[model samples]
Target: MDATSRHSKILDLLNSQERVEVEDLAARFGVSLQTIRTDLRDLSARGVLSRVHGGAVRVSSAANRAYADRRKQNATAKQTMAALLAEFIPDNCSLAINIGTSTEQAARSLENHRGLTVLSNNINIINLMMGGEAKELILVGGTVRQSDGAIIGEDAV
Candidate 1:
């Protein structure tokens, strides 16, 4: 394709990654090193990217969050699961739940149900249920697992 298209594509790839190797780009786009170099040069001239050793980094790369840290970035799935779990809860009935992140999501989903008794070993679930339609919130007190914020031990059983 043309230089403009190639430059745009290079910018797109750079946007997706903090650093992209020239060899990988060359293979992905079926182009030679010289062609990739020319595109990188054009992007650099436009101040859209800075050419690093064997790769290019986007101008905004410094502000982008690393992929490893972004694994827990959005909790959209959790929120959706919470909302869906609301449907299974019957009003004024007692429900027993385990200690887990997903279980907390299920408890959060029950926010709209009225006069419901929720028994859980999850601190987050108890806290969330405190101000909602929960008629009664029973927390099986025990040692809380800090890693996942779940209560676990003999007391929780």
Candidate 2:
């Protein structure tokens, strides 16, 4: 298989198995150890995986992938949960939303709610609620996490 196809398969394996050793990848792909190492390096550089001493693991935990990947997973369920939560949030109330794909979805669902003061550390949520019906949108100041656009740090406290 071509390098692109091989890399894709490696990602698939990593997604399902969490981690893959260099020797195992080489054997599975019928490639040399050097080639497998190169693939791991490339994936790690792209922030798709984390290279370890003998193998590579998915960049994020088993329950969580990268932000973009997490956004695609359980999307329908997130929207449903967002809708349910939005219902409980009455108008003219203040809320602090945290970082996470589900929270971002919930913020989207709250776009039409009038007279809300939404405070958040998630840049995605702040952007989503901007110019909406909320009475105020407060973005907590802190260092922005490049991987997930989440504002986190001591300053955010």
Candidate 3:
């Protein structure tokens, strides 16, 4: 496979396995060790993964992937879950939500509901709900997490 395809496949493996060794990647892709090393180096430089001694692990803080990558990952599945959640949540009801990509999807799914009040610490969810889906949107006050647009602290609690 080509470099782009190889990189995507490597990320997929990391999603399932959490870490990947250079030798294993080289074997799986039928590439040389040097090629696998180069790929790992490039991905690490891009801040997508962290290079270890003989392998790379997902670049994560608080066990959360990079915000952009997380947004792209499992999008359809997230949507499906959000739709199911919305089915159980009646219109004109109040909802409290936390931060994460899945919560963002839930906010999106609830956009069509009427007379909804949403309280959240997730900035992305607030923004998504601001398209007038919710009758009221309350954001918790706290320090904003630059990595994922989440507000956290005692104030948020």
In candidate 2, which residue ranges exceed 4 Å CA deviation?
1-64
Q: Could you tell me every candidate's TM-score relative to the true structure?
A: 0.49, 0.64, 0.61
By TM-score, the candidates rank as 2, 3, 1
Cand. 3 TM to true fold: 0.61
Kindly report which residue stretches of model 1 are placed more than 4 angstroms away from their true locations once superposed.
Answer: 1-74
**Model 2, C-alpha of 81: deviation from truth (Å):** 0.4
Candidate 3 structure quality by residue, lDDT tens digits, 1-157: 9999999999999989879999999999999999999999999888889999999998876355578888878899999999999899999999999988888999898889999989999999888888765469999999999998999999998
The candidate with the higher TM-score, 1 or 3, is 3
Which is the better candidate, 1 or 2, if ranked by lDDT? Answer: 2
Report how far off residue 110 is in candidate 1 (Å). 1.2
